[model samples]
Target: MAIDSDYTVNSGVTTGVIGMQDPLYLAPGDISGLNPVASPFNDKHYLKWSRAVKMALISMNKVGFITGKYPKPAEIAATYQDWIKADYNVMCWILHSMIPEISESLLYVQSSKQLWDEIKDRYNQANAPFLYQLRKDVMHTIQENNQSVVNYFGKLTSV
Candidate 1:
């Protein structure tokens, strides 16, 4: 099931919308001009908006509404950075957890050890395990796993 399907949910059907708790940045009401608690996300709405947003997100390749590199007020950043970080952290943790499974499933497993070693070689003195660097390392690991992902990104953003 592709998740974009016509079957009823959780009824042994092959497909339906992706289920809840996606932790999307845009809540249901954010798009429909309603309070976050009033519509879409609301039970009265039966999570219709939530499901719709999930479909939207699945179809939306790149969200343009977000400012790519815009400066933001500290208070605003502080208010929401935790949510973003936590959401991202959980997602990363899940993907990282699946690394071994995916590697086993595929014939060739692109190892992150080489990529990490190269990075460590580049910055010999900065060997401290830092959060920011760890994030980069994770990204490197993911890119190593999916050569096509790296190729696509590099293709689109060539220097």
Candidate 2:
């Protein structure tokens, strides 16, 4: 029996037909050793690092891997191995974007989605104390006569 353009297995999984240009497509030239971002994540700049990584992944068409859109296929599926390869490549890109200590701690994470979720969970906490301190600093900030308006605003926002 021939499969249709979109096929569904008895397991209730619908597999879409992917082409060579699909984001899920793992090209021969896609390497795992390259770091997409210029700076490694140092744990302090979670917001900045995450935005940079997201842009890089978006350019490479691999953002879906972390967002859990391109999930792994069943082991018996024809595209299972291809999905695994792409996932591994994405995982490497994420690891390479982090400092050695942070990456090493996450080395055992099984999938890119899991790794991404873990990192988000750890660094995305809301610190009331830190926020209060920043608010206080902003309130107390005074523009010195020597400081330019641009520099004064920059300092306030940088906090």
Candidate 3:
């Protein structure tokens, strides 16, 4: 028996080998809004919006683009072009999930990871002013006469 690019036999057992391209292949439909987050991120909904975006990216197996797990390759590397294309797709998905004002400000970002970090730093910070605002809103809450007791309670808890 002769061995080519196929299988090899060792100790009377045959093993098969396979070559796979990178998992970052993008379909035509994947070029546009991936609908990662149903509502555009408006700086006020970081926690809820980020969770939805992450789940969408995970579903597409593209979370690595934003997480830095798939680092960019050198310009001369064979995979560099493919990596860049996939990175752009991930960036587009993220941008489309954001409001125009926010996305436009990040238009020139070179990598998805950089954009992700920028947004995370700007919105995910736990600052005192934000906490103060939340406390104020909670303290000033008033239930309208037309509102049901359960609904009024929900509004307070949501704050």
Give the best candidate by lDDT.
2
Q: What would the TM-score be for candidate 1 when compared with the true structure?
A: 0.17
Candidate 2 clashing pairs, residues 3+ apart or interchain: none
State TM-scores per candidate. 0.17, 0.73, 0.70
lDDT of 2 by residue, 1-159 (tens): 121323345577756566655666656776797787889998876887888889988888889889988777779776676678888999999999999999999999999999999999999777898678878999999999999999999988777
**lDDT of prediction 3:** 0.79
Question: What lDDT would each prediction earn against the true structure?
Answer: 0.33, 0.82, 0.79
Candidate 2: segments with Cα more than 4 A from true spot: 1-20, 27-29, 133-159
RMSD of 2: 5.8
Clashes of each: 0, 0, 0
Clashing pairs in 3: none
After superposition on all CA atoms, what RMSD does each candidate show versus the true structure? Answer: 20.8, 5.8, 7.8
Candidate 3 per-residue C-alpha lDDT over 1-159 given as tens digits, one digit per residue, 9 for 90 to 100: 111234456997755442232335566677655657778998886887888988988877778889988888778544566678888999999999989999999999999999999999889989898889999999999999999999999999878
Q: Candidate 1 at residue 12, lDDT? A: 52
Q: How accurate is candidate 1 locally (lDDT)?
A: 0.33
